[model samples]
Target: MKKSLICALVIYCFSSVAAYAAENPSVKALLSEMSKASQQLNYQLSYIVINRNTIEPLRYSHAVENNVQLAHLVYLSGPMREIIRRGGEVSYIDSSSEPFTIRANYMVAPTIPLLNSNINELSKYYDFVLLGKAREAGATCQVLRVVSKDGMRYSYVLWVDEKTKLPLRADLVDRDGDILEQFRTISLAVGDGVSKALGELQNVQLPQVLSLPQGNLTHTYWKVSWVPNGFKPEELNRYKLSGTNQMVESQLYSDGLFDFSVYVSDRNDQSLKSQLVRQGRRSLQIYVSGKNEVAVIGDIPPETALRIARSVKFSPVAAKKVADSNAVNNSPETDVAPESSSQ
Candidate 1:
C-alpha cells in the first residue's frame, strides 16, 4: 500500500508538468513563425487596404530563386503604380514619376515589420498577446494583439493563418478601440516553386538607382521638445522641396512600427496653410509659426500628429532664449520658433 501511494504521487506530479508544458505557445514564437513563412514560402496575395473613407486594392507576390528573394506589388486601382523587389533593392514604377530604385530589405507595405524586423526589438515598445483563434480567408487563424505600453503609439490586431503561418489580416486601432485602417487578404495561394511571372520580373532590367543627396549628418541645432514613448531620432538632413525647390530641414522618427517625417521650412508664399488632412492611414499636420512653417506627416492619429508638431524646438543658448521669450509673450500662433539660423 505504501509503494502504491508513492507511485500515485509521482504520477500526479509528472502529469502536472506535462500539462504546463502543453500550455499555449508564446506570442513571440507565433510571430517568429509568421516571419519565417513570409520569407520562405512562395505565395501570392490579393488584398485590400481599407482606410476611414477609401479602400485600395493591391496585389503582392513573393518567391525565391537560386537563394535570391523576389517580390512584386501592384496597385489595382487608380493610376498605375508598381513595385518590384530583387534581393535588397526595391524599384518603384509609377505614372507620376520616373522609375527609381532604393536599397531596402523589404518593400514599404503594411505589416512589413513582421516580415523583416526582430521580434525582440519590437517588444521594447509593444506587448504581444494571444487573443485566441478565429477563421479568416477560409482557414483557421491565431488572433493576436499588439498594444503599446505607453499609449503613445497605435495598437494592432493581427490574424495569422495557422496552417500557412502567414498573416491573413491586420487592423490598426486607436486608443479608443477605433480601427483607423485595415488590411485583409482576399485570396492566398502558396506553392513549392516560383511562379513563371515572378521569374520574368526577377530578370527584368530595373531603372537606375536614385542617389539621395547627402546632407550634413552632424547638425543637432534643432530638436523635438516632446517625443512619444519608444520613438528615436532616425535622421536629420536638409533637402530641396519637390514643388517649391526651397531648402528645408527634415527630421525622421520611428517607434519600430510607425514612422513620421517633420519638415521645417522658411515661411514663404507657398507655405502650407495651417490645416490637418487625413488620407487612409496617414495624417498631415501643418502650421506656421513666425517665419517658419512646420509640417508633420505620418501614419499616425491626428491628435498625435498635432502634439508632435507643437513640440518642435530649437536648441542652444540663444535659440532657447528666444523661444522662451516667445512663449512668455504669446505673440506667435504656433509653438515653433519664429526664425532660427539653423535653417
Candidate 2:
C-alpha cells in the first residue's frame, strides 16, 4: 500500500511540473506574437521616453514590403533628427552631421524596446511572466514581466496591445522594482496607410554605408575573470578618449538583451579610487586596482557594474606581445574609440 501511495505521489509531482511547463508557452506565445506583429504589421507609434529628469517625444513608423523592412523614426522635440531604415541598411539624418547610412537591421536609437528582440534567444536567460491585463495607449493590453533568471541583471515590464499585439509600453526596472527608464506610447495607429506613408522610403536617396574601422584586437595582460552567464565578449579595443585623450583599453560584452563594457587604463591624475553612477538605463562603475583603473559601464544595475569592474584581473600573457604593443597610445595604428553599440 505504501509503494502504491509513493507511486501515485511521484506521478502527481510529474504531472504538476508538466502542467506548470505547459502554462509558460502561452506567456511566451504572447511575446512571440508581439515580436511577429512588430515586424509584420504596418504601424505608427508616437511615444515619449521618460527618465528621472527628462522626457523626449518621438514618432516611429514601420512597414514590410516585398520582404524588406522599412522604418522611420523622428525626434519630435529636439533639433530635427531622424533614423531611416531600408532593408538591412539604416540611415541617420540630423542637423549636426550630414546624412549617413550604416549597415544595420534595426534602428539603434531609443525606440520601443524589444520590438525586434529574438524571443527564443532571450527565453534562455529570462523568464516571461504574465502579469494580467491593463489599459494603455487607448487600448486594452496584456501586461508581462521579463525577469532575469539570475536576478543579477535588470528586468522589463512590457504592455502589449491585445488587438494588434504591438508593444505599447516598456519599463526598465531594477531588482528592487524601481523604474530606471520608461517607453510609453501616447498614440498608436495600425493600418496599411502607415505602410503607404513609409513606402516613399524606396524613392528617397540615402547615403552609402560608411566603412567603419575594426576594433583593436591586440591581446592585453588585463582580463575579465568573470561575467554573468550568457554574456559574451567582443573584440578588445585600445583607443584615446576624444576629450581627455586618455589611452584606454575596452572590451564590450552582451547577452542579446543587455550590454556592458569593461575598460582598463593606467592610473593617472584623473583616476578616481572608487565611484559608482547610475543614470536611466546606464550604470558606470570605476575603481582603482594597483596601478590601473578599471571601469564597467552599460545598461545594468549599479551593483552588477561594480562587481564586473572588480572582477577584472591581471593575466600574464606572452612577454613578446606585451613588449610589441608597449602602451595603449604608443601604437599609432590603434583605432579611435567608436560609439557604444548594443547587440
Give the best candidate by TM-score: 2
**Candidate 1: 10-residue stretch with minimal lDDT:** 332-341
Candidate 2 overall lDDT versus native: 0.85
Candidate lDDT values, in order: 0.78, 0.85
Best by lDDT: 2
Shift in Å, residue 121, candidate 2: 1.0
lDDT of 2 by residue, 1-343 (tens): 9999999999999999999766434778999999999999999999999999999999999999899999999999969999999999999999998999999897879988889989998999999999888999889988999999988899999999988999999999999899989999999998989999999999998899999877755456677877877898987877778877466788889888899989888788878879988777898999898878999999988888888888877643432344355454486344332323222
lDDT of 1 at 327: 51
Give the runs in model 1 whose Cα sits over 4 Å from its true position.
Answer: 1-23, 110-113, 193-196, 242-246, 268-275, 287-291, 315-343
> Clashes in model 1: which pairs?
none
| TM-score, cand. 2 vs. native | 0.86
